[model samples]
Target: MIRRSILFCLMIVFAVSLCACHKENPDPSGQNPDSSPTPTTPDTVTIAPVISGGGINLVAKLIYTVDASTAKVVRSTVMVRDDTDITPALVIDCIVESLKDESLNLSFDGIEYSDGVCVVDFDDSIFTIAGKSADLEDAILDCIAQSVLDNVDGCMKIIYRIHNEAYSTVNRHFAYDFVYMDD
Candidate 1:
């Protein structure tokens, strides 16, 4: 009877130990019975910059109106960020040099920012150039496009004009759709 009692006690102790072990081991599926806040992943957080309303510059006087029969002339001014490290002026000068002797002239009227787009307008003389070769014409457009791409990160598009007329077509080199190639 003593031996049988000892065996029963040992069995009970073993069963108790097994139950304790099961309690210590957590569920593999991670569905814990305890209700607590789970730690969040760090990658889910996003931070953005704060923009003020008065930061934009406008140049309303530089704009000129075009006649209804003629192509529309749109003038936009873009501000070069005072903090930007890039040299946009140098790029513009390079483009001007590339149009050497082509009678193409580009002027930096001023810098202005409106809405989210930066507008950089050139004088009407930029389009008044004459006697340009096919290659020179392409280079002129490329120069302007590249300048904007290289200098301005905020600018997604550029509008080209000659004497305030929409630069829709070129005479000898390409079609009016030449500006679309920048895409």
Candidate 2:
């Protein structure tokens, strides 16, 4: 009985102290006393693909969120199977897959990067699905080029291959060529 009484008293004291700790310790500026960290949303987000890369490396590809000033890289965690072929098309496909978000609205069939040239191959039917708007084309190309320039080393230019022919960036609204060095 005595032991139980002491335990009950201790618990009461603990509760009282805890309650006192939460008393109004307000700043002079008169903000809320119960201050907490504010939640902020990220700009770039990468989604996990349904066909996962079942391999050792967690981050198998990278995407990019671009603006006039800088390009922010968003990495993707794709684990490829051990015996899978790491082809040029596969690498660029992984890159494009990781970059599907609200900012850029489109998809591609295949991609290749070599000797400072990035080739994005898409079926001509993409226009039928997404419409024939010049703005969409510019945004899609800009997003693709930004992702390639940020992730692929020596990727100085991008070629949009629609009719099996390499096509360069004709509009030139954004600065896509980034592979330059002073050696």
Candidate 3:
């Protein structure tokens, strides 16, 4: 009787220990071990815009000066993604990202688009450029406008802002009264 009682007590202890070690499963279905849904990856696309030699192309014309007086325009296309639902802000982002070599030191604070208009808020970094000539600034602005016009479908105009205020002066050379992409 004592041996049987000892065996019963040992079995009860073992059962209790197993129950204590058991963890509550977040997913009652028991299909997902981690109780988290599977993650999906988005598709990516690569585009190569033709680099213009000296003449003009149909994509975008970026005008700048080599010396102090000689002005030049270089035409090129912007890289596009394969995904749908492309917004005007995304196009502006692509244009900003494409200027890797120009050293324009341009950065946007925020971009909002609605009703065929895109309002870009830029930081004061653009105005702080050391040697930003009038022609170069004009070319940069034109490039941004032309790039948006060529890429975005519904966007008809672009407004520049510095710190949420009107971007009236870049080195006090650009009046920057909103640019119409359609024009």
TM-score of each: 0.35, 0.41, 0.53
Among these predictions, the greatest TM-score belongs to: 3
lDDT of 3 by residue, 57-94 (tens): 23332222122133233554443334445676666665
Predictions in order: lDDT: 0.45, 0.51, 0.60
lDDT of 2 at 180: 21
Error of 2 at 83 (Å): 14
For every model in order, what is the number of clashing pairs?
Answer: 5, 5, 0
Model 2 per-residue lDDT tens digits across residues 1-183: 999999999999999999988857457776776877786533333455468773242334445432322233334444444445544455556544554443433456666667767666666544542354455455455555665565555656666665454433333222233322211
Instruction: Compute the lDDT of residue 123 as modeled in candidate 2.
Output: 66
Better of 1 and 2 by TM-score: 2
By the lDDT metric, which is better: model 1 or model 3? 3
Models sorted by lDDT, best on top: 3, 2, 1
The positional error of residue 7 in candidate 1, measured at the CA in angstroms, is: 99
How far in Å is the alpha carbon of 122 misplaced in model 2? 1.9
Give one digit per residue, the lDDT tens place, for model 1 in 52-171.
444433211111221212222223223333444443444455445534423345565643334423334446553443233434444555555655554545555554543343453345
Q: How many backbone clashes does candidate 1 have?
A: 5
Candidate 1: residue 136 lDDT (0-100): 44
TM-score for candidate 3, please give it: 0.53
